[model samples]
Target: MYVPNHLKWRILLAQELKQAYFERENSLRNCKRIFELYGRYLLGTTYDTFLTYLNQRKYRIDNLRMPPYIVAAIGLLEPLRIASERLRLRKMGSPWTLQEIVEEVLTILRERSSTPLDRRIGQAQQHVE
Candidate 1:
C-alpha cells in the first residue's frame, strides 16, 4: 500500500504537530481540524512535494517562517478541494451495499494510519504532474 501523495504531507505534518504540541488525547481530539485545515487542503496538489511550502519548512529552509496569510490561505482553499473530490468520486460509481461503504471507510482510515503497508505497484504519481 503505497501511501497516496496527498496524504504524505498530512502524515508528516501530523507527526510534527504531535511532536511539538500535542499529547495523545489532544492529538486525537484535534485530528479533524488538522485535516480540514491542512491535509484536505493539500489533496490533489503537488505543493506538498516541495519542502519549502510546508508550514515549518522542515528541510528546505532554516529560520525562515511561513507567513500567517499563507497558512490561512490553505484553510481557505480546502473546501474547493473537498467539493471537487466529491464530484469526481460520484462520477466513478455508487456503493450499492452498506458493506461496501463500511469497507471503504475502513480502508481510508487504515491508509491514514502510520502502519506500514505494501508499496503501491508503480512509481508515485503526483496530481500536478
Candidate 2:
C-alpha cells in the first residue's frame, strides 16, 4: 500500500519515543510523563508545527499509521540511540534528513515488488540453482 512520507516520519517518531521511555519504565504514567517531557525533542518539531505540516500536506494526523518509511527510520535510529546523549551534549547533524528519508522510503517501496511474473522469475532461477 502507498503511504505518505510524513506519516512514516510520525510513526518512526512514535516508535522511538516508546522505546526511549516506556521500554524501561513499563508504566502508562511514566510513559505519559516521559512523552510530555521529551516529546518535543523526539518529534523534531512542536505540536503546532506538526499539525500545520500535516495540514499543508493534506494528511490527517489523527489516523497516522506506521508506514515502511517509518519502519526504515526506526531501523536507522536504533543504532543512533547510543549517541543520543552525545548529540544532546553537542550540536550534531539531523537524525533523518528530509531528502535522505524520502529517498530511502521511495527506494524501499520500489524494491518491494510483488508481481507474479517477478516471483516466477525468482522461482525459475532458484530451480536452475
Candidate 3:
C-alpha cells in the first residue's frame, strides 16, 4: 500500500529529528514544538496525540540531532504540502472522500520515503529546467 505524502512528511520529519537532533533536550523540545504545531495544522490532531501515536508505534526521537533550521523547514513545508495535495485531489475529482485523500497521501509517503536525495534533487531540477 502506498503511504500518503502528508504521512510521509511526518515520518520524514520525525525520522530526521530522531536521527539528527533528539540527543539534546533542547533540540528535542524544538522538534516536539515543531511537530505539534505543524501536526495540528495538517492532521487536525494535537501534538500530544501525535506523540502518542508515535509512541504506540515505538517511534522515538530521543538521541537524534536534527538541526533547528531543518526542523523549522519541515514544520513550514508540511502544511503547504498538504494543501497542494488537497488541491490536486480536488482537481482530479476522483474519490473525493477524505479517506481517499488520506490513502493517497499515505501512498505518496511510502513511496517518497525510499526516494534518494539525488532523485529528489533531480525531480526539482526537472521542475525548474
Computed on alpha carbons, the lDDT of every model, listed in order, comes to 0.43, 0.53, 0.57
Model 1 C-alpha RMSD vs. true structure (Å) is 16.0
- Provide the TM-score for each candidate, comma-separated: 0.25, 0.29, 0.29
Considering lDDT, which of the candidate structures 2 and 3 is the better prediction for this target?
A: 3
Write down the lDDT that model 1 would get: 0.43
Summed backbone clashes in each candidate are 2, 0, 23
Winner by TM-score: 2
Cα error, residue 53 of model 2, in Å, equals 16
Off by over 4 Å in 1: 1-29, 32-65, 93-129
* Pairs of colliding residues, candidate 1: 1-118, 2-120
* Model 2 lDDT on a 0 to 1 scale: 0.53
> What TM-score does candidate 1 get on C-alpha atoms?
0.25
Ranking by lDDT: 3, 2, 1
The predicted structure with the larger TM-score, 2 or 3, is 2
Candidate 1 per-residue C-alpha lDDT over 1-129 given as tens digits, one digit per residue, 9 for 90 to 100: 665443444545444433333334454455544444554444433433322234443343333344566544443343434544554586576434545544555555555454444433221233113
Lowest lDDT 10-mer window, candidate 3?
16-25
Q: What is the Cα-based TM-score of model 2?
A: 0.29
